[model samples]
Target: MRNYSGVGNTLTLTAPYDVASGGGALIGATFGVSKLALKAGQRGPFEVTGAYDLPKDNAAVAEGVRAYWDNANKVVTATANGNTPVGVFTAARSAGAATANVRLNGSF
Candidate 1:
């Protein structure tokens, strides 16, 4: 499109806190996964426009269902109350499964 910004899928921003590659990074009010290891005060790119396989809570997550972020456990869950939704679960996750593929679509 003529108005397309031509920006790639990832965005570069200063890390507000230490973040490991593939780990969640919450910048200002935006949440995304760090594409590279970044220390506090460093600048790096993060993948914010794609799905990511992230850790999930101990509850089973049905395929195509929405999932929320459990800040306390640093994992995603199907629960809606008191937790911020992160994305839709792309696949079913049995209880106690280590992780779930989530199509990230959340904000701070």
Candidate 2:
């Protein structure tokens, strides 16, 4: 255990842009939920793992399907094209819904 570190569920990252608490942020290639509001260039904790209610596009999503992070739009999506894989949809989401439930996979 000499090289052990703390659990990585929450990690520190400099915000690339102003982000509110519970907002999704992508730093470099890592994506996670901000633990607190952070101004651009401020370093703070981000929860990289766990289920979350994330904003989504006007697209219906079926339960149990993989979810992707639409970084350009800052929303969770079912489309994989040009999007980063964040996790899976935990529940069905109808088109036009404001958000979708997702379980973070903790890795890009």
User: How accurate locally, in lDDT, is each candidate?
Assistant: 0.81, 0.94
Predicted structure with the largest lDDT when compared to the true one: 2
Q: Give the per-residue lDDT digits (tens) of candidate 1, residues 1-108.
A: 788864656778888778889977667656678899999899998877679998888889899998777666667889989877667899998999999999987443
Which residue pairs in model 2 clash with each other? none
lDDT of 2 by residue, 1-108 (tens): 799779999999999999999999989889989999999999999999999999999999999999998888999999999998999999998999999999999966
Q: What TM-score does prediction 2 earn?
A: 0.96
* TM-score for each of the candidates: 0.78, 0.96
Worst 10 residues of 1 by lDDT: 23-32
